[model samples]
Target chain A: MTLPAHGLPAGTLRRVRIVGTGLLGASIGMALTRQGIDVELSDSSPTAQALARDLGAGRLAEDGDDAAAPELVVVAVPPDVTARVIADQLHAYPTATVTDIASVKGRILDQVRALVEPRTLDRYIGSHPMAGRERSGAIAARADLFAGRPWVICTDEDTPAKDLQHVVDLARLVGGTPVHLDADRHDAAVARISHAPQVMSSLMAARLKDAPMDAVALAGQGLRDVTRIAASDPALWAQILDANAVEVRNVLTELREDLDTVIGALDGRVDALGVLASAIGAGNEGQARIPGKHGTAPTVYSTVTVLVGDKPGELGRLFTEMGEAGINLEDLQLEHANGQQFGLAEVSVLPAARGPLIEELRARGWTVPE
Target chain B: MTLPAHGLPAGTLRRVRIVGTGLLGASIGMALTRQGIDVELSDSSPTAQALARDLGAGRLAEDGDDAAAPELVVVAVPPDVTARVIADQLHAYPTATVTDIASVKGRILDQVRALVEPRTLDRYIGSHPMAGRERSGAIAARADLFAGRPWVICTDEDTPAKDLQHVVDLARLVGGTPVHLDADRHDAAVARISHAPQVMSSLMAARLKDAPMDAVALAGQGLRDVTRIAASDPALWAQILDANAVEVRNVLTELREDLDTVIGALDGRVDALGVLASAIGAGNEGQARIPGKHGTAPTVYSTVTVLVGDKPGELGRLFTEMGEAGINLEDLQLEHANGQQFGLAEVSVLPAARGPLIEELRARGWTVPE
Candidate 1:
């Protein structure tokens, strides 16, 4: 029996089969199931499939052996196995549209193309939802993980519009905004934005490997923010970086040049200050190029830092007051003093809301510090 | 007239003078004046001093021209000018304990030691309150700037106990936890943790100077976090880097070796994966070494990522519910999806509260995603 559409047209995607029950796969299944669509789960590891099933991501494929063929098959295996799984699934589910959610797209697409016939290729598209956490495994999966995140849909020149549409629908069904990008452009984009930062963060944190505890103790928000993502699973990261090595290498080579110049300046070059200043100035421009916190467009929000008492509910009361004032807190951070009894909640709101939020908080007898 | 100690003894610090009216200077003056202590402000820039005075940081030194010698004198100037200012203030306020708030301690302390006689040296202590913002100037200053932040106080062998105590009192008066570190150790610690990250962030962002716009549009939270501090003022950073050059250079050199190894692996050595994996894994260990969010001690907080609706008071309501459940929200980040209606509020709380918090949230009909 066909079910109502999760997001795509009715009957077009009544059932989805996920070939791997890892973080991304189970997450996709959970999201689709939450939308009232049927999802089937399988994994090379039976234990993992049981875990994903227990997590309510989907039913085990074994439990649905006699069920009709899935309308869609998602190959969510690791990059090395992704092509093999896609080929196997494409043959196994002739009527299903196939897609894979791998971080690196171009190489995987190339591999799948070599393994499949042109007709089989027509039913396949590659998509990547740009969402992840430091943790991994089925236990860490979430239904709304892809919500409001960007999902890149890579299409071949000969890809049918309808097939592309199906992949885009899957992305949207999970609450992602699908952006059309060619495989090459997608790889290059991730290499610049994702891979390079991972390398730099890893390298930067590597210096702290044997650092004195006291030295590490002085870590502030700046250092913390820059190195937060350095805690990602290393083996997984190595594979992702390996797949996107060429593009990452290109960026790293250029970054090394800048590093060398900084070293030269530090070695007491006559024009060291000028070199150092320009390096830092370019950084200012680069950082400004990033989209604002909300990710829609560029914005410069003003922060209204308020005194937050250590007592329970003080923060809650402050947020409640802000909410009642019709102010939306775009972001907030709590900075408690090293050994102090109170802390500051630096609340970032829309620039226009800054004055009103602060004025209202103070009017309500709260200490709205700068 | 003696005033009740603003967390310090009364007559011991009846009046304070700040010799610079920049962000840190103005913030200190404002916090002191708010506690009912007499504060005097001065700056080479008359406009700055006037603005700081108008902002209630303190009265202009003119108002205190005939006042008794300040019981305490603070020198808050640029790194290059720190030694000169400290020497000038020490001679100007012989009865007052003289201290300078500079980021790099060893170099400035050496300069001061060379400039001052033995008695003058006994009155001088170098301090650094590990609190700063990307912005500068008196306008950006806040009275609570140092609250809950670590303040490093460096003392000389000949420094009298009372003089050291007064400097410690200054740190506490502004709501900071005073930690004593020799100038050498303090400089080395900041060089490894702070200066090196600044250089790395700037160098990484520098590579984006000529990058395609489309690539930059793919920037995510990871890239933004790694480069957030790159927006700092270049000229000021260059000066700071110059003062801590030797130690910073040492760390950079070690980091460069790691970079070379990473590049070698990316070039496809047979042992590439192991090398790359080790680098990334070392990062995992290093990142864990950092103290928790507030810098007080190491803490392992579990994050509960809740699906927050876009409605104005949704966050407030959620926080209020959390407060009612007796969960102290330690830290938080709100990530809004691009063009999406809902956001994720990743709330950090005590690990013990994770299960209860999630159970309560789900029972209250909120979606607490993994």
Candidate 2:
């Protein structure tokens, strides 16, 4: 996981202290450590700090180890405790600038300001890296977790330019793209994209819990895709939703109206076809709003479905052959049939490459279904 | 696509008539035709019928053709037209055993029963092949589309064993496993797993349609997975949802209640964490109800994440090496850092194989991050 050094000095910061040793904190520590920056880690749970240390995130911090404070401190605690932790970190290292990576920013910023003195508030900022896996803890931490991810920094009137620069530099050091935003806007955006989706996905999957086994067995890739996020960390998500509940509720209310309209059409009170088509069309437009190079979906790309054994390395080989063919993949989706031997790899490529890619793969002893 | 066939007796019975030339109809025609059975295609749109015919789905039905009757008539039309088409097919081919592949079974069965004579009703059966793509029309048809998917048969009291066997034989010919259930059960099952999911996905995506670009850009894999099904055929889904509105509404109402609970927790009115945790836990349980090779999930399978380029053949190489390692992949997921040069292949294998697989992959010059 080592890479050539960058962000050699965290801008006048001789050392960095991370107050939490969870995935986000440990990952920040590792990323900074990789750049030869000195990092100290501590967690309320001794085992956790020890584990993060064992994972090479950083060394443990001790009282009076260095009366001269580190240049910066990062508080990566749970959302509910973020403000308190941020205030503590600001107080613990009086000279050090501090930032907390909390998904919900508005409340945390307000709470931290109320808890800390005006002087300490100037040295603190709130930021959130739009990154995480479904798993939790230091065990899930990686140096490259935040690479290429968006890290939103919330600015306050009391925040100093020096502290903001340090935070931005840290984000860059971790290979994150930093975006400047206010706390309210950041919270609102995340509520729309993150918290609401979690609730929706969970609500859908919840229906399946009480369903018959046969009905559940009737599930397909569509159901799998729609319910995948329903598997997120319950403890963490609960905290996040509570933090951003108001904005999330606004989104949820609108969704309810759409649901009610579709239900009415389905109930045969209106022209079902028109109502249903408009609902699905709205979804289509919404999905398209997700900007990417995915190209024109459900079209524009020719799908080359290669059947590989569900055993290990088959996908690797298939993709390797695709590389040899010199075809760019617009997207790749893998679908498995429970009782079937083959896993279906639906690779979407440019329509122009369809003939050549399929021909090349088939010639390379792969099964390319037309 | 040719098969040395056992459904040859189906060919001997006269012909197989597909009354719609869309994906399902064309696919059924192709599967039957490939099994060396005679197939006749007809659709309301001449262009659609012609396209299906050109795609080798089947030959077009002539004016004087099937005077005696085809052995089987599949009414693969929209849910609204299903009953009428089934009745028309039954009357047109009095001696033929008729089936409709509409998603909903109860209403269609009731409608057809009320429209047709007792004997004609006896000759018809309601069936739904639990398969579809996000796309529609003849262009998306495939002979193996139904392979490894469940085909549900809605049985009636008057359904003769011989007619049922004919339908079962058709299912087998298309590589489907047939499950027999009454119309009510079939409707309820599809409502829970299929129709309700569509409504939920669409409802979520509908929110995104008016979202700010930056907010949408904050979208991640979870959002994508949850909204992927929202891109389905709205016209078709509207009809399907309308046909099964009652059951869909029941599920939606319960979901609304769960939403309210979570909203309350978010509003700081209740023990937010407890309510949120329970809601998420319910989702976890419901997702678990999905019968699959995925056991406990996020735990059962040891994940060996292999870093590979987002290019054509990198994935193929990873899978090939996986096969060479002699490890069976329990499940595989591919995640790419948006705008990154490479994607990560997360291969889940048996816990025992994890250590060896990682060592082997690393030895072969692939990065297997823990």
Candidate 3:
């Protein structure tokens, strides 16, 4: 494949070996291969590696092949085996920089330190690309899986500058924007931002297990959003949660304290209203702090809700009209009306575009309620 | 305004009084007025009432008006004062059937029962329209606010058949699908599905208050979805939580028990993996119980994701292509690439159409990774 001119220059990463031909590994191989890099794929399961190779992720990595030693090795495996694989890769490719793509960094870093000598540890860097899909395995791999996603690189003060640059270059080559952080900080950040939220969602969803169907029938967007991640794979999450147990526990403990306060308030404690209000108010403040799309600061977009009929061509016409009007939608949310043959499409755009968009949609005979 | 033929017949509701011209009250008035009913709007705040009047919600309600006695009175007010208003409306219009649209029903029913005699109480029924917007007040009211949404009518064994029929008609006239539920059941349902989720979302979001900027920066769609409703109005939520404190507390206490188990598991308790797996597994089962769109049974739709450039008309062209290809989207989700001028549009279609749709999109020069 011809490399896009905007892609990595030819020699940035001439050859790389990716261990564990799973979703992340194979996807990295495919992306690098597309950029004119020689990517060698390997997995404990030969069939899995062959399947990835067949899918053009990379050529199979055979022993004693007539190829130059890889400049870098990417260890992409489950958290439980990540550390062991990194150690093996470091020993096998003595001259190569080694990076492992595990969601939890601190645990892997600790395990690696316990297993590898200090000199070998210098070649090992822990990284996590904050991108994934509900689906997994080699078949689900995509070349652009990491495009524009945060590829967090965890490094310590003892890390060699040249080695860090190699990892950063690999990240950029695959369309990732790398953010540097320490292993502990990365684990804690993910605990607060990702792992804890997953646990909370599952906990909330578990409550609905025995709920009366009538009660469940009343589920709305709020419940749906809160429980969406509850549908994640349990086995995978089990590994992730266990790997970062300490940090996850710390965050959950703090959450439980607040939960106790809310429970106490519900039990009619003194200043109950104050407790409830403060909890919700704190949420408003914290939720506002999350960055918006394009990794920019949080933006308050103006939403114009249009009534849409549930038909094949209806939404097409609506969006076509929006395009003709030259309004770039910052975001779009479609809410289906219960038991009706229609839905509400909430189109969010810059605040300045709200009035004009509403007027244009209305003029085009769409229902733009005042 | 000409009444649509599908609207309530003229004689069905000759006159209706809406007391409390907030979002719900004003919206009800506007819907009834459009259906050729004589809608008399009243609120404690004359400014709010007048604003509703000027906005075409209804004519102003004044003492000794020539209009015939209202056949019904809707008490649409905040939860704290809903019962008192219901009682007053029943006393003022002794013959009129009265209903209050408060989110929580049991407490209001108990309070109204305490404030009124049995005969007067028989004239009152409780209802909640499962519809609202982030924005409130008369100006934000839409005549179709309740369109195709569930309007739950809470009735008791003592509720008169005629009075119940009147409410059902009113709900239908406002474009709502009436759901029959008792006051206690309604409270419990909302507590489980709405109130408890709100508190949980707020609780989880509150944990992010002191989160390091880097931690918050790592926020992904999972965190975003879990905390979306955390931005809800605190004062309004406080009242809802307080009114249904018992039921909300019950659900939350159960959630806390599961949370404690997971925390214990994290603390290295025996069978920790089993406990964690079951917690997430239960969530999977519960989340699957939520009905899909149109209030149908949960149907798994195949998703076709396409990469669209971030510019005006890009999504329009893509969706227009699908429409022309005769594929109706079951759902659509847009995920922006962080710091990139492109986004992934995940379009969900019926399972049978996934392959054909993917092939069609690829033929149209859009990227569809296999």
Best by lDDT: 3
TM-score of each: 0.95, 0.94, 0.97
Cα-based RMSD of candidate 2: 3.6
**DockQ values of all predictions:** 0.67, 0.61, 0.77
Q: Give the runs in model 2 whose Cα sits over 4 Å from its true position.
A: A1-14, A293-302, A311-313, A362-369, B1-14, B66-68, B293-300
Candidate 1 lDDT for residue B265: 83
Better of 2 and 3 by TM-score: 3
Ranked candidates, highest TM-score first: 3, 1, 2
TM score of chain A per candidate: 0.94, 0.92, 0.96
lDDT by residue for model 2 (B1-370), tens: 3443564653233368899999999999888888877889999999999999999899998897645467788999878888998988898887889999999888887898899888778989888898888878898887878877778998877789878877888888887878888888888888888888888888888888887777787777778788888878877887788788788888888888887787777777889789988999899888766766432122366787777777666766777777887888777676656656766677788899989988888899986654
lDDT of 3 by residue, B88-142 (tens): 8898888899998999999998999999999889999999999887678999998
Candidate with more favorable, higher lDDT: 1 or 2: 1
- Per-prediction interface RMSD in Å: 1.6, 2.4, 1.1
lDDT of 3 by residue, A203-249 (tens): 99988889999888878778889999999988888889999999999
Model 3 stretches astray by more than 4 angstroms: A1-11, B1-11
lDDT of 1 by residue, B279-322 (tens): 89999888888787556467888899999887667888888899
Task: Report the number of the highest-TM-score candidate.
Answer: 3
When candidate 3 is compared with the true two-chain complex, its DockQ is 0.77
